[model samples]
Target: MTGKSLADYQKEYERIIFFDQPKKDILLAGLKAEMEKQFKLPTRSKEWKNENQKVIAMYRKICITRML
Candidate 1:
């Protein structure tokens, strides 16, 4: 694996670790605020439900076919 991808994953792991250990609502709110500012997104996009259902359906089909 390339060092670039490893660095990316390490960064993600550190963010997850911070979220788990802090368990602070204020900290989580700040993170969300920053993301919204940087991405110019609503942060809680209404399309998430439709998007989630599509992703779950894709996974279900894959698991069903692969297990057969």
Candidate 2:
């Protein structure tokens, strides 16, 4: 986890989600907005950062499985 880069997961997630650049940007924006709304925390806050890391880990697992 420490060594794994967000860039790797991002590329994998994009591959799995199959969205074009524009749509992908929109989707990511919506996801971020929803997370901010649900958590009621600023994105820069430690809690939000931890929560986001968890979400990214889960998504990375799903992306790995999808790739296989």
Candidate 3:
């Protein structure tokens, strides 16, 4: 599979799940904050890599589930 950036997966998931502008903005901001916290480690660290993969997998699963 082609590699997708975290932002790309996030945007796709957001589009699939969030319809209201106000709620979407609020929720997305909160999610972003949490992700920022989780990603505090250096980009090349194992923990960071694991977190990134986990997030991408989550987004893909959520988007697929929502679409079904």
Q: Each prediction's Cα lDDT score?
A: 0.40, 0.53, 0.55
Q: Write the per-residue lDDT of candidate 2 for residues 1-68, one digit (tens) a residue.
A: 14334565456455646776566656655554444455443545776567687654644454344444
Report the alpha-carbon TM-score of model 1 versus the true structure. Answer: 0.32
Q: Estimate each model's TM-score.
A: 0.32, 0.41, 0.37
Give the local distance difference test score of model 3.
0.55
Better of 1 and 3 by lDDT: 3
Question: Which stretches of model 2 miss by more than 4 angstroms?
Answer: 1-16, 43-68
Query: Which runs in model 1 stand beyond 4 Å of their true positions?
Result: 1-23, 43-68
lDDT, model 2, position 54: 66
Candidate 3 off by > 4 Å: 1-17, 41-68
- Candidate 1 lDDT over residue span 1-68, tens digit each: 22223234334334543444345334444444443354343435657636555433433433343333
Measured with C-alpha atoms, the lDDT of residue 27 in candidate 1 is: 43
All candidates in order of lDDT, best leading:
3, 2, 1
| lDDT tens digits, residue span 1-68, model 3 | 44455676567556735456556555555554454555442245776567578774654455345434
By lDDT, the best candidate is 3
